[model samples]
Target chain A: MGRSPMNREDTTKNRILAAAGPIFAQRGFQQATVREICDAADVNLASINYYFGDKQQLYIDSVILAREQRAQQFPFPSWSDDTLPEVKLRKFVGMLLKRVVVMQTIPWQVQLLMREILNPTEACRQLVEDYFRPIFDRLLRIVDELAEQPLTDLRRTQIGFSIIGQCLHYRFSAGVISLMVQEDQREECFDWDELTHHITEFSLAAIRNLGSHVAVKSSPRTSETH
Target chain B: MGRSPMNREDTTKNRILAAAGPIFAQRGFQQATVREICDAADVNLASINYYFGDKQQLYIDSVILAREQRAQQFPFPSWSDDTLPEVKLRKFVGMLLKRVVVMQTIPWQVQLLMREILNPTEACRQLVEDYFRPIFDRLLRIVDELAEQPLTDLRRTQIGFSIIGQCLHYRFSAGVISLMVQEDQREECFDWDELTHHITEFSLAAIRNLGSHVAVKSSPRTSETH
Candidate 1:
């Protein structure tokens, strides 16, 4: 059990992060103000300064906290497990989708992190290295184990890019996706279990056929220019 | 030949769009000012108001112009032509990557548009339908022809989401990707031919496997239960 003061400190910091997540998600980093954050957290402005220095540092802390929460919720799978590669990949996908889609659990800090990705700042580079790259490397190792021809690191990286690309498009283009699919509930449509099943089946097929070195016989060059 | 005044007017509009694309890309919509746009275009601020009703409309028009230029450069294969599905898909991927990857293009507009999607505006809804839905629909039809399962409309929509997801990941996570991938020229690593080949092959494998309906065997539940 934690001491009373320690628990209070933890609770206060978490409350600030929880409040900041959605606001940062909605308004973005530059647009969001320190006063607004303090108000949202129901804490004095001094508390934030005391705990995390300034607004920029507070924002960074919020992101770090969210990232930690995500990791804890969806910890990296053990490589030693005897699970089939397909099943492992599917679970990974499901966990990822759930983390991204469930707004109640996810803080707005993630949305801010994504913003930095599209238009990066100096801070984003360190964030990526510390938090994101390892997860991808883990993903690549899993794909390599499953692939037919033993994917080169380069190829695995590309596949990783593709897998993530497919997953994130829904989050990035929710409005267009809703219109195209005729779904009233956009958030609901990104159902984790269902999407995980679909992508796993799809991505596994893609990886299985890769690096087989099979000759793709093209139609005779009609122009004969070459 | 066009009359001199009309030619001048067209040229001025083109110049404004050209300048605005880079400026808008560097600084997002909120930050990008009419004064900055006019300064970059080497025109009076009054010219922007004359050419397009206001700054918002000007930005939209600039994006449209960029899209038109992309369509011209990477014209879609004629549906009338008896092209192979794989060939068509590969070409489509190439066209999409080329269009989206460029620093100066409507693809940059796409980045701006993505920001709005995370935190939508009224404008995002209309823009989604007008600009983006049609693109997904076109891609879906191609996947439909290739997929072995006779995929339902919902499945096709999901697949469409995945394709876009993978393709756009580069722009979406540019900073992180550059750091993580061990390449000399980080940007140049997104090779169109290679990437398109991988995506097309991966998508094809996934589509082909849909016919089999082989469910992956599950592993024993992990100790860390949610």
Candidate 2:
């Protein structure tokens, strides 16, 4: 009976976070209210303060939860010493595309995380070293293996961003693309399998070519600065 | 003084459209008010409709003006028949990256057009046929010239998007990127010249490889559909 009070507290906190994610995503932190979140969770007004300490803390927790849930759903596969970086890249893009798009109605948690990344709040400063840096580090390593010649740090970082930029474009530019592209054309590229395959092949082909071409182009002075 | 009335009317209309561009861009079509725009221009309340017909028409004109001003400032360079498509592509990307990112405080017009693309409104459907279609056609042609072999329409379209997507990401993902990339590393990729060079090289490499690699991977049935 004593432990049940603690269990109830846990349930209430979780419920508040569940309700807060969509509201924050929809309205943004500046506009979303604690009252609205409490209303959505069907909890007492005082429960949020008692559980998470404050609204900002609740928002940060919601962002973390969104990231954590996606991580579990599409957990990174273990790679052996023999696994090809190209293959790892394809798998990585596939997972990211799945998280970013594909679903008819995107899950709220995914939207919240995507929004956080787009206009990151104070939460991101704290989270990036822990979350984004490691993921970014993994991407850079994959790009490193794909390149045959030694890439300067800045050049390698650009390539990493180029691959990610392609994926992000599909998610953020849907409205623009829809107006520009024919419906049939949209289906062909936007299809989950087709997009993953295209991004992987495009990045691979570029990666294979970058070593010889860009090394001559990148100035030593600039590269050394970075 | 018969002509003075016509000139005054022209000035008022121009003033309203100029004022509306930033307001609509900042607040978006749904949130921005005609009252705010009138106040900004320091014109009477009735002057808006008298000049532009209605708020919707006013919003559309603001979008068109934004596109036109950027076009005039950064007019596409004319190419001779012998000019290589790769050169053309590089020039094209350079101009675009300039419009999208290089300006210190992105001119209000540029921001308005970008917002229109991301969450297109009634203005887009009308503008797409006249404005966007020609630009898109030019991009597809550039890719067509660069491709050594025949590409299916869907394939060509995807390639076009891949180039445009890379450019769009740099504009939209600045906050996320700033958090992930170090300040020193950012200058290497983000300096106007550096980004244009990287995108062109990356896209060209991918285009050169596409004929052999993607043709085999693209199913005949899917390619035939579009």
Q: After superposition, how far is residue B60 of candidate 1 from its true place, in Å?
A: 3.7
lDDT, candidate 2, B1-226, per-residue tens: 6444553365777788778999987676767888899999989899988877888888888898888887788776578899899888987787778878734566787778777776577777766787667777888999999998888887788788889889878887776777777777766567877888888889998888767666657543322112
Best by TM-score: 2
lDDT of 1 by residue, A88-183 (tens): 787666666665654444446556666666666666777778877877877887787787665555567788888877777766655556666664
Worst 10 residues of 2 chain A by lDDT: A217-226
Cα lDDT for residue A170, model 2? 82
Per-candidate total of colliding backbone pairs: 5, 0
* Regions of model 1 farther than 4 Å from truth: A1-18, A42-54, A77-80, A102-107, A184-188, A211-226, B1-18, B42-55, B79-81, B102-110, B113-122, B185-188, B213-226
Candidate 2 lDDT tens digits, A1-226: 6444553365777789879989987676767889999999999999899988998899888898888878778776557778889888887787778778736666787667766765568777766787667777888988888889888887888888888888878877776777777777767667877887888889998888766565557542322112
lDDT of 1: 0.66
> For model 1, how does the per-residue alpha-carbon lDDT over B40-97 read when each residue is reduced to its tens digit?
8888889888888778887776555555555567565454456666666766666677
lDDT (Cα) of model 2: 0.78
| Per-prediction CA RMSD (Å) | 5.0, 5.2
